[model samples]
Target: IALECILLLILQQIAAPGPQESADDSPGIALAWKAHQIIRSRFHLPLSTAVLAKELHCNADYLGRVYRRTFRLTLTEAIHRQRVLAAEKLLISNSLSLTEVARQCGFSDTSYFRQIFRKHTGLTPAGWKQRYCKEHINS
Candidate 1:
């Protein structure tokens, strides 16, 4: 339920027009939005800018540039963010080990998963889980 709410919020943010963007969306904005949807749906898979661009029938560089410009983040960062969000929910709601959580969240290696998780959340997966559980249990 928490994960669903977060996903919905992210989608809403992506769909909302930015201050500089007009009501009539540009082609790049449209493409970026499509990319965002694809990232959300297929986040559990091995995703890359090349793979996404191929699926979206656009050039990889163009897609990367448009996605970065539209969202102010790189495509790889977006994918990592989605995976980390899902990982956070799994960490709290399941008894899965860190390796299992990393695999299930589309991270190819546990160490890499830890690195990215800490980058985003400022804590290791286990640390984040422990802190979160402690905080919620006391509430």
Candidate 2:
């Protein structure tokens, strides 16, 4: 919701409504959006703050600071969050193995994937999948 609001505000500021309107020409919103989009779109890849900064042509610290300030979370956190979300869907709907899910969701190790998934959802992937499947079956 906050992200949507920022996008809307950026859109509104991009084109002034009146002849005397003052458009806020700050690139911070756009840059922040770009970083968010990259995380969302490329969550399956091995990405880092330095890699993102290089792609955006900015210093790593500056990018992290700006992203944190704009979104109230670090870019790394956002990426992990997104990856876990994606993994949930894959786990529930697909018959892929745990290692495959982890690999597809940008995790290099299955243990790490389980650790992160457990951290976010408080359930192991297999446990979550079992519960989800049972619920759907009963539904």
Candidate 3:
């Protein structure tokens, strides 16, 4: 009985949301969280909204609506943000080139990738990396 109780407690902790996160965040927030999990689960693979929708058991349009409404950003924007954030981490800690980072982050075109990075971050990828490294070194 004690072992079962301990297992249940552990499971509960694993499933529980953060203390600062409220249960009433929104339907979109819930959908975004689910989407985030699905993306992370298949991070190594090429993925799309159609694929994600199938995995999530929802229509692509509905998923997009929920995602945008909940997060105040389009699904594409959300996905790009995740990809860029991953790229940022790699840029800071790894020796991968910009093209390599773009490829690894799901951007097939190097030029388009640079444009998107600049659009989102207001800095070229190289500039972002330089500033990031400088900040870290100073800190």
**lDDT-based ranking:** 1, 2, 3
- Model 2: lDDT equals 0.83
lDDT (C-alpha) at residue 53 in model 1:
98
- Candidate 3 residue pairs in backbone clash: none
Best prediction by lDDT:
1
Among residues 3 or more apart in sequence or in different chains, the pairs in candidate 2 whose N, CA or C atoms overlap within 3 Å are: none
Reference-based TM-score of each model: 0.84, 0.80, 0.70
> lDDT, candidate 2, residue 23?
36
Cα error, candidate 1, residue 81 (Å):
0.5
User: What lDDT would each prediction earn against the true structure?
Assistant: 0.91, 0.83, 0.74
Best model per TM-score: 1
Residues 1-139 of candidate 2: C-alpha lDDT, one tens digit per residue? 7986896577545432345533342365456668888998999999889888899988889888767756777888889999999999999878999999999999999998999999999999999998988889778
Off by over 4 Å in 2: 1-25
Q: Write the per-residue lDDT of candidate 3 for residues 1-139, one digit (tens) a residue.
A: 5985795467445444558756764554566668766665555367778877888887899888766655466667767777777778878888998888988888888898888889889988899999998888778
